[model samples]
Target: MKFRMAKKSDLKEIVRLLADDELGSKREKYEDPLPEAYYNAFSAIENQGGNQILLVIKDEIIIGCLQLTIIPGLARLGIKRAQIEGVRVDQNYRGQKIGEALFREAITIAKSEGCGLVQLTTDKERKDVFRFYEKLGFTSTHEGMKLILN
Candidate 1:
């Protein structure tokens, strides 16, 4: 498998991956229906900017996707941090380490860009998912709170 920055053309596949049951439930619950805004946000990031959305491809097929945002921070002072989000592997490809490969590739990209740290948030109800993040070397450092605005 090869990791590459996503293109606008990949939006459909990305959304399909996101819509899978394991990943889409909460997002669907809130959004009820997915909107073009979500796709637009991802496409903007996937373009050549400080932010990036990457895809794992094998044999010209998109197998997974992850978004990385490089934040220029005052706290880090010339340092940046990467916020990784929407990591999802194709339902058929789970348990094959494709997700890990995608994450490691993102980490490499972040490091090359001088990111001081990489951060991500996962739902607390998914205990197994939390353990997976822990196994991947992420610590539960902060509580995440959100206020959704329609």
Candidate 2:
């Protein structure tokens, strides 16, 4: 497997992975010629200096993806942090260590970017994901809440 920053051409496969799960199926509109909004959002993220969508590929097939953003904060002595989101591993490729490789590469990138911490939030209903994260040394140190405006 190899890691690389996602390109516009890889969006379809990335969306496929994102939409494979029950929770994602409700939110992602993965279709042939995906909605324009996805392209627009991807463009916005691509233009951001500290944000990137990373992808994992094996034998030329995209199988996993995640978004990483470096944030500058003043709370911890102006420490910079890496915020990870949209983590998804292809359903057919689970239990093959892709998830672990993804995180390992992300953390390495975060360290190279001078980030003091790396964090991400997953839905409470994803119990298996919680355990998966714990195995990677992540702890539930804070409570995260969200309010939907849409």
Candidate 3:
């Protein structure tokens, strides 16, 4: 598998991987022509200095993806942290350790960026994933909250 920063052309495949999940299908709309909002959002991240969408490819097809963002904060003594989000592995490729590989790559990038820590959030209902994350050395030590504004 090859890990690389995603190109605009990979957006649709990445969305396919994301929406293949039970929970993601509720939030992501993966269609023949993906909504302009996805493209617009991709462009925004592509232009940011500390943000990137990473793709895992095998045999010239995208099999997994995740977005990594380096956030510099004053709360942690001005340390930089890596936030991993939107992780997904293609349904056909699950159970093959592709997700694990993606996480490993993200951590490697975080270290190169001088990040002090790496963190990610998953829905509590995703019971199957909690163990996988824990196996990867993650701990459930903090409560995560979110607000929706329209």
Candidate 4:
């Protein structure tokens, strides 16, 4: 598998991967006519510094993708940390350690950016993903909560 930074044209494939799963299918729209909001959001991410969308390709096809955002904060002794989001691997490629490779690359990128930590939040419904993360050495040190608006 080849991992690289995602381009604007890769958004469709990325969205497909995001929507392929059970939870994502309900939250993400993978329709014939793609939404303008997706492009708008992609553009926003592209224009932002310290933010990256990564794609994992095999045989010239996109099979996995994730987003990493490096945040500078006053906490952790003024350290910068990388927040990982939207991690997805194609269903056909599951249990092959592709997700592990994605996280390794993210960690490499984060360290290169001088980040001291990498963090992410997964839905409570994703028990398997929780175990996967734990196997990756992530500890459940804090409770994550979110409030949706609109």
Q: lDDT winner among the candidates?
A: 2
Q: Assess every candidate by TM-score.
A: 0.87, 0.98, 0.97, 0.98
Residue-level lDDT tens digits of model 4 in 73-127: 9997999989999999999999999999999999899999999989999999998
Candidate 2 lDDT tens digits, 39-135? 9999999999999999999999999999999999998899899999999999989999999999999999999999999999999989889988999
TM-score of model 4 relative to the true fold? 0.98
**Clashes (candidate 1):** 0
Ordered by TM-score, highest first, the candidates read 2, 4, 3, 1
Estimate, for each residue in 30-95, the C-alpha lDDT of model 1 and write its tens digit.
343457786667666756467877899998999999888888888956779999988888889989
Q: Residue-pair clashes per candidate, as listed?
A: 0, 0, 0, 0
- The lDDT of each candidate is 0.82, 0.94, 0.93, 0.94
Worst 10 residues of 4 by lDDT: 29-38
- Model 2 residue 106 CA deviation (Å) reads 0.2
Off by over 4 Å in 1: 26-35, 46-48
Error of 1 at 45 (Å): 2.1
Residue 47 shift from truth in candidate 2, angstroms: 0.5
The TM-score that candidate 3 achieves is 0.97
Give the per-residue lDDT of model 3 (tens digit) for 106-127: 9999999999999999998899
User: What's the ranking of the predictions by lDDT, best on top?
Assistant: 2, 4, 3, 1
Clashes of 2: 0
